[model samples]
Target: MSPNLAWRPIRFTPQLERTYVQCMTPRIILLQRLACIIGIASFVGYQFWDLLLDPEALPRTAPIRLAIIAMFAVVLVITFVPSLRTPRYLMIQYIVVYTLLGIGWSLILAKLPNGFLAGVSGFLLGMIFIPVLVNGAMQAAVILTPLVLGPLLVMTLAGATRLEIVNAFSWIVGGAGFAVGFAYLLDVINRHAFQLEQLLEAEKTRSEKLLLNVLPAEIAERLKAGEEPLADHCGSVTVLFADLVGFTELSRKLRANDLVNLLNDLFSRFDNLVEQHRAEKIKTIGDAYMAAAGLSGNKRDHVAAIADLALDMRMAFVEFCQDHHLELKLRIGVHSGEVVAGVIGRQKFAYDLWGDTVNVASRMESGGLPDEIQISAETKELLPARYRVVPRGEIEIKGHLQRMTYFLQGGV
Candidate 1:
């Protein structure tokens, strides 16, 4: 029994997608086959009529005439119908076209008097053309050569067949053969074209999903199409960095997947916080996360954005600790300065900022006390008095000669 119905409610399956494709493929193939059959029937019908009435011939008696029409009809049915598109139908078409051609043309040629050799030649030459498949140019050559040259070649060479109309119908066989072959060829081209297009659409869908995974939709599009910021932009933005203090110990206590899930959960919440303040997240390095604001097209007010986010994170982490009973703390640092920012990379591209301002922002986080928010003096200059600023005293930040730092405790 199929498991699809049993598990259908739990997950989606490829079977549904396949069902739609299945209905379409055969319907189209059938249509093309039908058109090929109809075209062949019309060409052969006109030829049979014209040939039977030719004045210079032993007239078509019922048996011979009936045989010729019957043979042609069978060939047309088998060759051009969708039912015959399969291998079984192909065998039937080949048997009919060749057998009828041999019997009918031989009879007509035998009566041509001096036409014997030309008829033989036409039969042999036609065999060479109708069977071999090549480009459309070859098909045209096959049909037209017989029409214009049948009498010329046979009569001019062997001096036979005074009936110009008989010669014309002889050549019309070439046209009929070419028409059938050409129609078949066109359908082949159409099917291949559709397959190519389907592959491209699949690729486009996969690419969209990947882009969504890497960056937010709006940002990814601007970066994808090579759009650039209007000017060499500058921004006063808040940068925030968060790192787990002893994740190595946490890793030792949990499975690899557990640690990964924990990190994913933690960072996802952090991302939500960044969004809540309309900030842009930069990147995450394992247990570390970096985010910034004002560079997301904001030329100013980064300090305020970072400040507000820093307070929210501290409160959220406190609540998380209480609920999960997991001891947790975050060191958040905020700095505001003009940073040179732009996008980078071709594959897995990212937008980033460089310059002393962004560097100072990272240092503030590292220099911060766990459970506290740290801000550089430059950041303090712009912040409102709703937050109490505690001077951490002048200290040497790593890789810096000297710097002043302060703690932004909540409002007094």
Candidate 2:
């Protein structure tokens, strides 16, 4: 069977227009429609009343009052068209169109000797304000004032059976006065809207950066999209466990605030070392600090990176204690193997590591003595020429068999 020619295409009708309008932001759509309707209604009412009541007595001298009516109808139709929806682009169209509307209506009033029917005058003077409110008084004036003035001057030359040479000029001056007043209000609204949009964009960017700092970049993206992916990514990471050996004595000697400040200062130095080696800071629980390279994020040569960080932390603490006339000892243990690390809690989030490697590394720290840097035999083989190490006889690591460990001094 052939396709039915009667159903070739359904054109966009009033029903389709209404459906589209409903889908747009209702408030802005309603206000723009209402403003346009009010202008058109007032213009029609005056045109009808003047032409019907007494065409001869009516003060208009325009040979083409029908043309002015058509202009206003076109303006109202343009306001609701979907093409004028781009905020930036539509704003330009709005400014140009309303500017012309303001000038054109002012000219129609100018052709009348008395310059506006009392009720229509109020609306014409009042409704001609959207442009001024949206752009600026000066801008609306510069764009529109001339379009109205020249047209009005020509319309004023029309005669009510030869009344125009003297009477219509007075109406032109009065119409110009109303345009100036309405244009000022338009400028205020324009400036205010622009400022608000700029501020909103700045706040959005600042919030994005703050989120990246709080959560890793990948986690932040998942949060924005409302997905809670597995936070842990398992891998063979190098874990480092460090603690102050004399934490008890250090806390006892200093005031509570001073102890906290000292810990903060010591940890701050350690944080720099960790970053320098591109490691993830696992958490500082009390005087104990834990870090790992290559978990929750990627790394190259994870074991060597962590060993360098551990050595730097040890030296930094020694220098800190010596400079302050306080004795500080650091026991750091590093192990390279498979482990799981992730943020574990909802509130007061903590990044923690799990698995046998984390346990063995912690045991190496607990088994270590004052001022010593210890590591698993697995970790020792990755060391470069910068660190010194000596084999420590097999030490029993909790939950595991006795494993040979090493003490890190300077370089091996």
Candidate 3:
């Protein structure tokens, strides 16, 4: 997962090493079982060779073969031990047991009649099969070199001809070289696949985060689940709209980048407040921010949450203005009613609301006084008695007759 754990020629980070071991452990266990079964069968079957080639050698080798079979049985049983089943521990066990098995085979070969020829053939097969049992080139070499040279050394001490030694050396080294090359290729391919998988996982995480930022969590999941025309009739929701007072004139005076920076700073604070109060920020239009509560789950206190969010937004905007040395005001409007909320657009998707409640909330912001939070009668009725409100009665709302409104002052 981290760059530091990327594959290297000789050494690997602990994370990569653990991952490799985890991936290979089951395969290794299977191969170990197969090896044990084959080794037992061949050792039992080879008693005929002892009878035909050298009757004198039978008594000497029979017990040794039985002992080796017992050892193979022990190794096979170790694989099933629950305590030793971790990846690293199992790998270590495999290496140790396999190396010992190679040694045992070498000793058995040395005991047979015309043992030099038999040892040469046996060691050649081992060198060829080493890569499949082990993972990396270095690991293959570790098992291979000792098995190859150890038997040759034993044969030399047993007074083998120089020609026999030379022939065995040539064949064993050639096979080991080929096996090591194949092991290296396998390592490279495995590492590439691992890196690709990590990249894909990271990309999926980023896409999900971006989607969550664009839409509410519930809506995003619905879209992901192939729910088309995603819409809901919210019977009770409190919507809040806040617009920066005189931002149009301020934008005219400031540079484009400065204007954007100012809006970003101010709205970023509003975003934090929305999160703190458990409200879903619908979207921002220029200097105006829209958010709603009770759009997702059962939040019976949605009105109170939106009211607290609006008050916090007013305070946060005041602090932002002081920090930036500007005289600015925020006009926030609150209204509670039914609305149709859904995801709109196929390309640049938007989660928005459509209903008379949304229109009335917007009109509350547009028609309200600067530096104040305005609320429709529906919202005012839901507020706790702790909050202070004064009637702004009979305001002329756009596309509607005069309606009762109130200015939300502050908590008593």
Candidate 4:
């Protein structure tokens, strides 16, 4: 099987793109520093070797020494100067000055006795390992040209024998081939590493966004940090359930896509209201939307917050129905009590609430009339004096005994 066939490509989001760009500058700078150190140190080492080998040759090679110093100055500017530190700028400096330095070294060798034994081929091989400095194939080829041919050109001009010239030419060809091949391999490896980093970042961002959608921010973070079997007891939390009236019959009249779109539009409006009131939306089942306040912390004003959310939802539905020329009504029910909330299931897990509080809240919505907000007696007690709630008398609820319910009228 093809490797690409099994690999699922991740989409690089805008945030990940910015992260990649931010990462690139520092990585390039690090490689440039490494290259500068290696290049400079090698030149110094070669100069010392030449001195130890042929001390008399130094006076004759004064021009060559000056050329090496000039190359050193160029490298310093490319390394320490901020403007000339980029790959493009450094590439230009290396191509021009380093090439000339290679020619000067060749001239120095041609002037000395037993010049071939100094091993100038080793210098040509060092050109392959400059990391980020030699970024492209063309740049590598340019740097190799002088280092490869300069020796033979100088030997020819200095009247070397045919056998000596032929032997040096063979060494030059071998060194140049190895340098070019190594440069290409390094280029491939560096590019592959960069791409792998980008893909990993993209995957991380996608996972975080998916987790946040399923759980609250605080809970998602805890789960990411390896918290398991997540569960919590929330006391004095308010649970609100809002269901769309007449949606079942409406669905029968419209196509599947149209019905889905309508539900998405209505639920999306309710979602905005939940956000505005700082209430966490639990999940939507069919046409019903569930939310809770104080379950995810911030319990001081949970009752008032849920109350505000219900009112906003009522207004949003009114406006939405008016704009769409539809006659949809919203029935919202709220109750305040103790409940156990937690994340469950190892695969496709969901954050959900349990206990009598959740059960009674659902009953309040199912038992209530259309176009109104209903509240259990427990929720009514939590409201402030400024808000108005009228008793609906004792109403028998399914799966439970008779309990007092109230209608939540408009607040002052």
Give the least accurate 10-residue stretch of model 4, judged by summed lDDT.
Answer: 3-12
Per-residue lDDT of candidate 1, residues 382-407 (tens digit): 88777788999786787787788898
State the lDDT of candidate 4 residue by residue for 277-360, as single tens digits.
Answer: 988999999999999999866668899999989988999999989988898889999999999999999899999999999999
Residue pairs with backbone atoms closer than 3 Å in model 3 (clashes): none
The residue-by-residue lDDT of candidate 2 on 1-412, one tens digit each, is 1345332222236675344323333444455666656656765666755555446634552333445456556656766677755444445655555555545554555554444432223323433544533333444455445544543444445322234423333543455555655555433333344445556877988988876545556556766786544356566788888988878876887898988988888888887887788787767789999888876555667877887788788889889898777866788888888876555566655456678888888988989888888888988877666677899889987788889999877744
Top model by TM-score, which number?
A: 3
Error of 1 at 43 (Å): 30
lDDT of 2 at 322: 85
Q: What tens-digit string does per-residue lDDT give for candidate 3 at 302-378? A: 98899899889999999999999998788989999999999888999899999999999999999999999999999
Q: After TM-score superposition, what is the CA distance of residue 47 in candidate 3 from its true location, in Å?
A: 8.2
Residue 229 miss distance in model 1 (angstroms): 12
> Would you estimate the TM-scores of all the predictions?
0.49, 0.60, 0.80, 0.76
Root-mean-square deviation per candidate = 13.4, 14.1, 4.6, 5.0
All models: lDDT? 0.61, 0.64, 0.81, 0.78
